[model samples]
Target: MARFELKLPKMGESVAEATITNWLKQVGDKIEMDEAVLEIATDKVDSEVPSEVSGILIEQLFNKDDLVQVGQTIAIIETEGGDVVVAKQEATPIAVADVAKTVETAKESVSAPANFSDSDKFFSPLVKNIAKEEGVSVAELESISGSGKDGRITKEDLLNYIKNRGNQPAVAPIAIGTAPVVATQNVAPVAQKAAPVSVNGGDEIVEMDRMRKLISGYMVASVQTSAHVQSFIEVDVTNIVKWRNKVKDAFEKREGEKLTFTPIMMEAVAKALKDFPGMNISVDGDYIIKKKNINLGMAAALPNGNLIVPVIKNADQLNLVGMAKAVNDLGNRAKAGKLKPDDTQGGTYTVTNVGTFGSVFGTPIINQPQVGILALGAIRKVPAVIETPEGDFIGIRQKMFLSHSYDHRVVDGALGGSFVKRVADYLEAFDVNRDF
Candidate 1:
């Protein structure tokens, strides 16, 4: 029997590490090749890691909630083979210094007040450490709702609780102790508590799901981080609309994919990015990193009412047919919750189709680190002036609005406005006679 190292596969170009959220297989469990062994979550997405070779799960090198770097062996699997494969060095658990750093970073205005072991509730090691340093007792931790899987208290949930904990009255009276005194001194100044909502007898209160909580945090953080600004442009897409109508049936028959307006819009967006490369960039603390490739992030809404952005790498290189395939594949996978973590990584720009919900136009928040996001409004037939060499006449045309939201910190009005305009220009100039 030979031991095979089950390492964390490389997720994406920008992803270096992930947090192990759960272990599906324990030690001595019979494992099959390509069977999922564990689930991990990166900042962008969560995915399961599958075993490479069929074997017995001999050892687990990392615990749930621990950060694991890429290419590190997470577990050891024993398989029938000629010779025993020498195992690499054991996985290093998070060091004391790392834990201290994590606590210190999350520690803003409060110190630990209560003992954690007093309660039977399960808390992740990282969340417990943060709770310890931030004065969250077992009772208080329990009172705060969790948005993690199986209602587990995640670090974000704990931190958000701590942020709002000071506004409420103390859970219990402080006894005569120096620890309480220090904790009080370190606590944030008490702010006005939010007004309570008056619920009717028939009203129902529902806790947000894990993904919705995550989305809430991201939306709030984005508004705080970037100086958001929006630019809107109305374009007549009669040509593109007619063109898609003319070829969608044939295109789907030939390519085995439904031709949607998303890919066409994405194709134009890609061309616009190539025309204005400055818009295809990310901000890194007083520095600007211009992207070499046009990776468009397609923001798709899931069936669970959550949002996800799956990227099309090198979108500028794909033809219209390729773009449609890429868009359809990623979109289908996203809806099915089968997208890998890497599918959501390294997006230099994002596009959201608000039109799907019948919105005429919307000022979308910028997906951060990246400077810009585009929102496609719904197409509507409207009266328009038709100019020709022979005469000018009123005609019905399909029109839609393009809303561009960009970080005003790095992107000026001219660049942001011009980028969306270029996208509109491309869409308006779409070839009606082009082949699929």
Candidate 2:
């Protein structure tokens, strides 16, 4: 038999690692080529890892909830054919009836909590490194409170423990491959569980899903990172609406796609970014990096009710037709959970359609690394004064509010206000007779 190592393949340009969410196969299970063996989840996407060759699964290197780096061996498969016989070892320590009790203690040190090699509890490599640096015993690690998903100890949890390590009572260090951690009456409790709340029987509690948790952290981080300030302006988009209504049918018939007002607004936003390139910039520490490319991030809601931003690169380069295509493709893929990692990266600015959910206007939080995000409000037909060559009269017109949120540290009121104003200007100045 020949042995093959199944490694986690590279998922995307920016993704370096993924967390093992589940295992579909156990040891000694028959596997087929290209069949999924495990499911892995990155920050923004979930995907299955498939077997590269037909084999019998022999071992699993990592358990569920463990973070695995790209190209790392996750499992072993034994294929039929070759004369090569690979050594297989059980994850647990084997007992030798002839060995002394001291030898058993050594095996315990090599496998369990004392030496920190407990496979039952998942500790990331980063956390293990930090533990090694701080001289924390496996017993101590078992005690540290984990705030991460599934009670997994995170790097932040380890760092916080280090910061407060002085308050911890001094204990004898348990050396790896040496011996077990001696139990004491003064020992601090590890694996602190949250106090369970008593349900009234009718009360149903729903914990946030993985994506929602990630989104929650991101939203909080963005709020803390940027000095957010918003500017709101109302614009009359009667001409743009009229133009879209006039051309939508013909455009759909000709281009084989429905032409929506989103692309039209996105086109105007892109042009306005070119007009005021300062808005097309990102904030670094004490530095403002002005972006040359006008990549627009469109926030789309997924079927699971999670929000994702799939970007359209070179928004300034694409015409109305191309913008529609890009918007449709990205929007469709995002909703279908088919967007690649690169499709969500390199966004210099973001636009969200709050109108889709019936919100009149919203002060949206900024997408990190980028300075600004624009929220488009619901369009409504309201009475307005129409100034003509003859006289001024009250007439009905379609209008929507533009809510622009920017980093106050880098963008002043004038620039933020003017950039959004330029978008309004483009929308108001749209050609009624222009061809798609």
Candidate 3:
């Protein structure tokens, strides 16, 4: 028999830790390879951690509500087989500290073990690099407290430490990048704390769930950061509606996915973004990052009443059939609580179908860093004027309103309004006779 450590798998590039919600198997519980043994929840999604090898659960290192770091051992299993290690990809960001050193300490950091925790706490690679550059010894690094998830050291924590480090005295100065240390310093004391909430009869006070809290913070931050403005346009999707109705059954039979207005709209949005590359950009402080790829974020609702946006990478490259598959696959996974973290990242622009909830149109909050988000409204039959060389007459048409919300800080009125107008133009000119 051999013992195998079941580590918390890396979730995503930006994600580092997750809260263990439930453990399906306790010690001595029988387990099979690839079977789910525990469940975890990150800020993004809830997921199951499966057993890597067929074994009996021997121990669980973490408990419910305990935050576990990626690559940390959460459980150990006893298997009746030779060692078959599960391969894992670890994030290793490399950087050089701008420190003129005796060269010994800096060189030592190069051979430093990947697990460069100053204490029992784990530190990310970026934090370690900063420490090495700042000539922060292991003792000094541990003395500074952590402010990240599960009390892990974050980049901000290190930077603040460097700023106030003169107050603390520690090991002999390397003289390379060491700060002037003071032996004596006065420390501030906490006098009082906020009162806890009191519940009274007929009072219903529910704490915001983790996901809700994250979403709330995100929306508030976006509104606070961007100069928000909106542009509205009414689109004649009469041809689109007619085209889908005529070919949806055949399209589904051929493509094995439902034909929704989303993909059709996405196709139009992608083409518009291609024409107006300025809208396919992200804001970085005072600079604008114009993206070469047109990745579209399709907003979907979760079962728990929260919202998640799963991106369709390189959306402009996909054909109508490809778009339908991507939309349906993401929508189904999102509704089923099965979306991966990567699915929610790297979105250059976003589109939300407020129409799904009978909304005429809405000005959605811009997803952060990204400059804009477009809202699709409910399609309704309305009477319209038809013009031709022969004559002009009143006709019934399917129409929907579009509300484009943009960051006025970078996007001007003409550009923002014109970009959405192009989307409407594509929908209005959809090929009713085109093949699926």
Encode model 3's per-residue lDDT on 307-367: one tens digit a residue.
9899999999999999999999999999998888778979999999999999999989999
How many residue pairs clash in all the candidates, one count each?
Answer: 3, 1, 0
C-alpha lDDT of all candidate models, in order: 0.82, 0.80, 0.82
Q: lDDT tens digits, residues 1-436, model 2?
A: 8888888776665565678999999998999998989988777766678887898999999999887766778998999877544333223211123222323323223332234445346665456644654556677776666765445686667667666767865556557788656444543346578898899989988999888987997897688788999999999999988888778898999898889889999999999999999999987655778898999999998878899998999999999999999999988887776676668878999999999988989999999879999999999999999999999999999999999999998999999999999999998988898877
Candidate 2, superposed: residue stretches over 4 Å from native: 1-6, 24-37, 50-60, 75-201
- Which residue pairs does candidate 2 place in steric collision? 143-190
lDDT of 1 at 363: 95
Badly placed stretches (over 4 Å) of model 1 are 1-5, 25-30, 55-66, 71-206
By TM-score, the better pick of 2 and 3 is 3
Looking at model 1, how many pairs of residues clash? Answer: 3
